[model samples]
Target: MGLLPLFTSMLLFSWTTLNAALKITKVDLSIEPSAAVYRDTNVALRCKAEVLTFGTEALNRVYTIYKGDSVIYNKTTSSSEDLLYHLPQARVSNNGKYKCKISIMGEEKASEAATLTVEGMSTPILRFNKANITEGESVTATCLALGETGSLLFSFYDNSKEVENARVTSNELTFVPKGVGNHIIHCSYLVFVMPNSFKSQTSNTVTLTVEELSIEPVLKISPQDNVYEGDTVNITCSVSNVTKDYQAGELLLSQDTELLKSGKTSIHVNWTAHARTPMLTIKCRLYLRDVVKVVNKTISVSELFSVPTLKISALEVFQEDEISLTCRIAAKGIKKKSKVLTIHPKVPVSTPKIWVSGSAILGRKVEIFCLSDTGTPPITYTLWKANKQNQIAIVHEFNKAANFTIVINEPGRLNHYLCKASNGNRTPEQSDKLQTAVIEPMTEAYLMVVPDVDDISEGHTVILICSFLGTPPVTVRWLRDSDDLNPLKTTTTNINTTSYEFVVNKEHTDNYYCQAENRANSVESNKINLVVGMAMWKKLLIPGTIILVVSSLVMVGFILFTRSRRGKRERAAELSVKPASPKSDDSLTVTLTHDTEVYNAATDAASFCDDKEGRVTNGTRGSVASLPADISNRSSYSIPATV
Candidate 1:
């Protein structure tokens, strides 16, 4: 067992020494150029294996290269030699983890894996012409990829976000950014002819800053035109979109380059506009660190807010008068405007006027107008009779300058009308009452004189009344002896009668009559015959006295003659007788008759009938006692002479 143990120890010793000699002391993995290689370029990878000591014999050594977990190349080398893997031209597919393996003297050792990457082109560079610029200003950026032979796909990014891509090796882009911010600009490129394809490595970042500029100061004015004196005008100079923090600057209000007001904020300038400054050109100015903004405005001052003028077409107004009124206003900075108004003027106030258009006779339609002269328009008329409250007829019509017409169907006496007018602008107005009279129809006229006695005494005052009966208002005329009498002697007493008074005389003792005339007809009164003479007592007394005188004289003469005859007959008596027979031619006869008051003596002869020439002759006278028998048979009467 001891011998076996010794032999085993020797074998273990040789194995231990051999194991120590084959163990790798150092293993190194590297790539030529020590950095990333471009596409289609030659690249070499080296792996070195070192041991504690070298073996003299022809050592059995093998070298192997691995990419990731797969072997790419295998070879044999001595213990003192280094391993190299060459790629004639690197491709994009040659990128990955790389490792080397070595085996010598029947022992193997491995190295840790290293990484290699192949790109299509070199890294691009980004450059900006200006680091900071105002907004709306142009900026240029350049992208360059060195050692790039073919076309390159270059992409630009702002803030790690891709903005644009172009297929050019060297590119310059000019643009204006609207926003204001810190912009980081970088470029990435890919080689079109390289084996590897993808987004390339990014370039170095360049910052491009854009800021917003302040706007020009704008001048603002209130009450643009027609500005009055003692009015406040507001002016403001303001800047917009300021990029940096700024304080309120001086805002200037200037007129014709002379500063009127200046303040850090908006200002109100109270300016009195007069003839000196009828027109003004004002400016507003704002100031920054080294920048200024100015704005100008023009203003004109004139009259404003004036009272409107009133014009009337007429001063005096009557009924049915058309009137017009105009109101005109003239203002500054505005067009002139006017208003025209139409008016219907009213008449003066008084009682209502009433008139009948036609005759007011019975059974006739009469038109009555009740007019009120005071109201505006649209008068209503109503007709009524006396002692009645009810209306006869109503007229309602709208006429601004017309009267109301009321029609009566059958007009009668004591008819009254009333009128009312209202324009809805004032109180209702009324008119006075109107009464009507009866109308007369034409008729035949008749006239007469009073005191129908035909006798008129002289030197007597008599009233000759000429009375006429006809329609009222008959004219009376007096006529004497078929001639017109003077009007001074004729007096009218009433509408239908007249009177005349005069002293009766010889010239006035003529026939008088009256003629009455009207519109219908005319007629004359009956004639009155007047006689003027002496009194009846005086005329009869004179005639009676004359007749008495004549009768007395005759009686006295007869008596005296009788007395004288008696005296003469006593002195001488003589008788002469003539006897006559009955048949004889000459005879004396006598006859006597009874007494009568009146007697005629033309044929009487008798005896003892005393005649005026009786003579008594006794002796010679024959008695006439014998008469004719018939005459003697008559009654005999004694003759009483007498006294």
Candidate 2:
């Protein structure tokens, strides 16, 4: 191929433009495998000249090859055609500029220069995405070229041996480890150069360590202590070992045998505790294939709140009284704590009850009380007196108590009275009216004798009368001087009067009075005196003297009758001696004379004591006799007879 430049000039041109006498033709140059070539490879080059020339032809032609102006080959040929140059086993030193030249007899022509290139070797690197992992875990290995290459195929190797079916279209390879150990890994790539294929150098080795998988389950609950009833609790169960081989329902959370939530490696659940009865057991379970791990916790909730009870002290309460009250809660199996409080209850006003308890005498104080019932504190009491016109007037008032007192300064002040009470809440209450005249005992009384005169005779009965003026009926009592008399002798004749009937004597000559009394007051009547004289025996002596004078007159009359009878007899005898003369012969025997006396006596002894008069008469002698009236004794004279 080095003589191709002289053969191309002999086949076509016989002319040269530089020397006009000797003409040369134009030529061109080219090389096969025009792209860059690999080290220790082959390459070829060609040169041609124009076919026609318009100049004198040359008998002899020469061809030569040059490298950057230094000739390497020279040949002489008599034919005219194209020339060829061949470079076998090309190296980095053969890479440079090349050209071919032609000479006809003494004229020469040159072709254009052509260039050649040769590439050097490149290194490959091996790397992995993970250094250590558990068995059943996946890993990726990558191989990269430092220089540019086309149409590459990557293959992985383990332990200096090619892995079966471990080819990949990309520079990376992914696989799962079946066993646990430290394994060396690398990759190699094949590149197709122009006309053939070449394999690159093996990449740097890397080691992967695989171990057994182990993890523990953990349980956590929010608000670990002092939990109350009816509160929501959050429970979380988790595990640290997570991989692509993890299946659903690996971790579970439950409360008291009831499942709440399930997840892969971790789970969460919310539970509401029961009211006042919270004793729950929480459990967390982790299932790794056939192996199981579990954890548990217990929670206890406290009780609820209650209202307090109140208790007060003191048996009875009064107005403006201070008291204490204590409050506490009665909880079972709990400590007791008490709180104290102070209170003051109010007192209300009511009707006033009044009582008069003093004498009705002038210049005396009377007490009245107004009653207070259940009400507020600080009661007011007012006392009122009613006059003759039935009008009331305030006499005494008490601010803090329900009592009042008043002085009776005059006798006319004994009238009606009233009492009122109040506590400033509403209208005041009043008691019923009470009259002093009706409640007071009888007063201003007087004692009257039946004759209303003082002097009286002794050994005789006299009448003593008592009378008084008061509102209520009064009981009268009789007294001798200042002492009380015997009630048997002094008897009550009426509601307000008593009579004392007894034989008057020297002991009854003292002053006597009558007393009148009632519930309110007592009074005494005016004193009365009686006088008795000594004329009792003189009245008896006068009746005795009259009865003696009447008895003496009867005795003297009998004496005078006797004397007259005797004188009559003497006259009769003298007449008898002289009667015998004349007309007396036949009747002389019947002419006799006699004297008769008459006496009258009283019937009762009282008339027998009176003075009497006596008469004497003699019918036979015609003579009358009279008795002396002053006869003192009837037994001192007897009847005198005449014979």
Candidate 3:
């Protein structure tokens, strides 16, 4: 019985172990059409797996396909038959290394890699939208790569030079040709894939003829016959071919460079005839994009009256003299008549006078005046600068005077000015140059000493120089210690520098400055302190006296120190007393006495020693005896004598 149970347990364990061992083996991948095919061809990929399962129930199998390193398709099913993955309209992007994998339970297997290549693209066909083309017009071009797929780049060339490129699926582009000539055009395409791309051959060439615009402008005149002066004339300009098929452009009617009228299609103008010129040329212009068409016509104008003749009673006449004059005129088909009158002759204007008023300083406004004398009632005056062809200003006045206001910006620029006058005479008379001057404000003033202060000694000659930058006629003044009331020297000069020379002395050892003034402004120079040195002989005498006094003091100190050493030795053998110790509440008293007349000196020495050590406590008292007369008045303490 025990052996039967043991056998049953062993059988159960063996069956369980066999059911868990599910695996996949022998995986094969294949492509339907050949390994290499053209683009847009339908393709199929087959993945087959041989699975070994010991269980009664079916095991789930997973199928995965790869292109390069990316998974393209995956599926899970309970079937063991071969599976298929279809690619509709395969393109160049599908050309790469492909693989398949099968998985059952925990065990899987992969098949070897297979390569698919898509090659060969159709030659591109090129065509234009119209048979004939015109300048300034656009044309549509179509390019086709019949069997190609994926992204494509189409290029259009004109005479072997690329003009346009488009990346589109419809493959159509519009462009305009350059100039008026026959152009040879062709097109090509590029097939773009992930790992590889292919370019097709050029298309058949087509010749395109571009012609000029066919619109012509027409010009017409109303009075085609002999036209007379003071008559109104009409002009018309038109374009016959301006229709819906053409673009709208500008139309202009002009005489020479002057435009009389402007419109979209046609223009009209009314002008009065003049006898100044015998013949006049009128033009009509059609303006399109980068193209212009012109038409012109000429007309003649006749004079309506002849030139007048005048006769005077006297040839030589002065001002305020009366004279008789006769005026006559004759014309074709008109009567001639004469009229007598008495009038004064016209007088020409004299040369104009020019002057300036107001301050002529920089950055200030000033007025320039111009006047002409002994001229007609109305006269024209003009102002000009020397050597300049253009006039600065002009004015017409019955009083024969004019003025121009301007700000002066440059110094000494008023000399370049003149004026002219005219009253319908042969030529204008001019005035002389202007005589105005410009003043510039002082910017800086500097004062300097010829010999520096350090080098100056008694009886040395020193010079004080004042320099400045400003207009002429400047006043310079030298002051002592910045005191204007006590000026040492003052002068006016046209030059830039002025100076003063004097001998150095005790009175010269003081601060000095200078001031410069002009019509515009005044400025002061920097202050300078003068320190005169002593004479050489006096400097030597002062050191000699100091050395003699120091020698006498040294000898006295040596003699006194020797005597003090001897006295200290004698006092070393004298008896001394030691004081007793006291309690905290009791006071300690110390007395020092000297017997000589120098007792005040001993008291001073003891006080110095006490300061060096520390302050005495409140419970302690110190005293000196036998003070001197001067010392006793100040204090009573003195040192006592020792036996």
Clashing pairs in 3: 593-639, 593-640, 594-639, 594-640, 595-641, 624-638, 625-638, 625-639
Q: What tens digits encode model 2's per-residue C-alpha lDDT throughout 1-643? A: 5589888876555334424554566877777776368865667767666534444554455778887777877878766766777777655445567788887656677888877665654557988899998756678888896553456778888777787667776888888654568878888887654345567677788898987656778899997677765567888999866666655438888877789998877787777664334577888998764456789998886654444556778744556667777676754444334444445564556666666555454455666555555445456666776622222233222333454666666555444677766666568777777555324345578888864444466777777787776544566677776456563243333365656666676666767787776655667888887665444665676777778777787778888887766665454334422222333122222122123222222232113223322211232222112223322122232232111
Q: What's the distance in Å from true for residue 190, model 2?
A: 99
Tens digits of lDDT, candidate 1, 547-634:
9999999999999987865654443232223444332233343335433333333433334344334443433343322222233233
TM-score attained by model 2: 0.28
Off by over 4 Å in 1: 1-351, 355-370, 376-414, 417-430, 439-466, 470-477, 494-503, 515-524, 531-534, 538-542, 545-643
- Please say which candidate is ahead in TM-score: 2 or 3: 3
The clash count for each model shown is: 4, 26, 8
Task: Estimate the TM-score of every prediction.
Answer: 0.26, 0.28, 0.35
Q: Arrange candidates, best lDDT first.
A: 3, 2, 1
Q: Model 3: runs farther than 4 Å from truth?
A: 1-210, 222-234, 255-260, 268-276, 302-474, 477-556, 572-643
lDDT of 3: 0.75
lDDT of 3 at 632: 23
* Local distance difference test values of all predictions, in order: 0.61, 0.62, 0.75
Among all windows of 10 consecutive residues in model 1, the one with the lowest summed lDDT is 624-633
